[model samples]
Target: MIKPVKGFSRLSKKEKIEWLAGTYLKDQPDDVETLKQYWNEDTRLQQLHDEFTENTLSNFYLPFGLAPNFRINDRLFAVPMTIEESSVIAAASKAAKFWLDRGGFKATVINTVKKGQVHFTYKGDKKKLQNYFDKIKPVLLESVKPITANMEKRGGGVLSIDLRDKTDELENYYQLHCRFDTKDSMGANFINSCLEKFADVFEAEAQRYEEFTAEEANLEIIMSILSNYVPECLVRAEVSCPVSELSEDTEMSGEEFAEKFLQAIKIAEIEPYRAVTHNKGIMNGIDAVVLATGNDFRAVEAGIHAYASKDGKYSSLTHASIENGEFKFWLEIPLALGTVGGLTSLHPLVKLALDILQKPSAIELMKIVAVAGLAQNFAAVRSLITTGIQQGHMKMHLMNILNQHKATKEEKAKIVDFFQHNTVTHSSVVEQLEKMRKG
Candidate 1:
């Protein structure tokens, strides 16, 4: 029988990931050739190569487990996240437990709507093109009726359609914006379909020379693409944890703890090097989920990094504190992902992960991922403040170092002891371990 996570005291460092993943895949097929084949499907190998060559890979896999005790918006969920940094899963789990003692994370999503742009360049006179959309707004909306019917039946659909005149020095183009509900998916394909459906109408309306005569408006449909994904829609989560839960022996004050915590983070905010790693920790959580769900990590990565340096230079990705002596954390990042079709369906294991989630739509998954990111950020900042960052992390590293050379348990223990006692001299430690094994 699967055991319930009690707390930090009961956790075993060696089996952390296996425990956290729970019924999730334990031993992913270790056959390198087979694994390489799996990874190569859908040009993933090329992308990974590009990423690796860019020197952007920071091996961020740690066995940090966030214990369950959360109920978000009256629903129970077991959130599993993979990240390599100490304290993130622990801190988030701690904060979540505090909230569980009260109510849970009260959250709501605005709408799962996204915008796609269709750019049309024409000599139909920029002013005339503008008037065309203005005149056909009702017709376009009417045409969207059939497209949106299914979404409407499911309680979502087209909220509005907009057009704007963007004139380049060389030529003029009209951008048509279609805002529609993606239902439970990312809605990219659906949005693209809607735009294609309007192609005939758009061409007829912007008709230039029929067979090379009468009119002279050279209409060209350059690109029908999605917008930059402005998050006009949102999923907001507010968890009110009782202050009583976080206190220790002398009845530690949550407000005071939070204030001190904020002060430490303020230091990271002021320093660039610290900010880079600090922000990387936040992405640790976000990217892990993006990877696990087979979602586009690149889009989320671009959006977040861009958001961090929005004012110019990059900075932290989360804001956390205590309100009324209760911990409160908020994180915002551009999360453009789909739970339906495409990669989500293409991979077999991906489907299994989603099945474990038992979530109905992409929005629910996004909320869970957002929570993980906040949890991870909290874990990172808290560790930096309370203990020196290297302490917990180095201990884990010791295991990896000892695992090198296929060291036996006793050899591993000896090496760790020597390292901890400051007697480690790389060549000496390895020679000693080998000598002991030979004897």
Candidate 2:
């Protein structure tokens, strides 16, 4: 039986790896070398990767790819994506190319509002606290002027602040709910800085008010932070064409293909199980772009999933329809993205990705990100209704299977070409590789 180890974190990297190998990889002599093999070749680059998060492990690599020919709002952009899963970039590029001549994607930023909250407890009187809030609203705004001045010069800052009574949810729980226009940055820091300042101002001003009783004057601050649920920060991306233009590119008519595609989306709409996976497929594209641009993909993902369930039940994020001989597919998602702050300018790859995108503003990035999701879902649905998802997905996954089996370079090339026409499966690839070895 394995026993617990002490002072593990105090050990050097080499020592830590040595202990781990002795304890866990006793049967596999070469596993330690395999782990070390993935370390970055450049010492400086490795240092940067180590500092990205805690515990300085070797870098884990994901393929960073470019999906080109994306025409959004008459401007072409080559979107960058970083993800481990294959076929996503291929599918997105295919959809972009498919729609390149058919008006491509159209995206609009409906709102750029972000949310933050300052929670506190005031126990004496609701009306009195309300009156106190009314009197100090302007002071609250003025207190954050120092923080907001720079953001204001850049055309972004706090938009509104309101006192929210949530005593019904919990005893004496009142909040100073606020909204902001973050402009071109994912203004978590900016919003949070302002909120913390607001809390300080509210507390100090309440102490100065003569109408406030001793109990009401001493408001206990629970917390102040920005919210990840920004339903108002919305962007809509859509593609439309005549139903007759939708075809299987083989023999199926356009109308028939459109019907099948709409049915696939409809099934995802009402079915919770399917909708979850369906929305995840869309996120595959959205997250890839979000990471490449150095924004918070996890927050965007949480807010989007919450929006998906806003109508009482989780459903599809992308929708499709045929109206008046037109086939339209679209997605409206809340994405709080930044093009100027966080890792955008600090990370090298993020800088390159943003520059490659022509350094769009926050709203422009929102539209582009939304288009990525829409395009990804359309490609997935197109595959689902026509050739089936496995055919393309397995084909893309074939090389990964080959690599896992330790196929030689020459063997990989030959097998890749062979699988182009033939079926691709784990067992099938293994059999083919074995046959080639014999030959």
Task: Specify the highest-TM-score model's number.
Answer: 2
RMSD in angstroms, all models? Answer: 12.5, 2.2
For candidate 1, the C-alpha RMSD (Å) to the true structure equals 12.5
What TM-score, to 2 decimals, does candidate 1 have? Answer: 0.70
Worst window of 10 by summed lDDT in candidate 2: 50-59
lDDT of 2 by residue, 280-394 (tens): 9999999999999999999999999999999999999999999999999999999999998788877789999999999899899999999999999999988887788999999
Model 2 misplaced stretches (Cα beyond 4 Å): 1-36
Runs in model 1 deviating more than 4 A are 1-67, 82-104, 122-124, 138-149, 168-171, 208-216, 238-256, 267-276, 309-315, 321-327, 413-439
Clashing pairs in 2: none
Q: How accurate is candidate 2 locally (lDDT)?
A: 0.92
lDDT of each: 0.63, 0.92
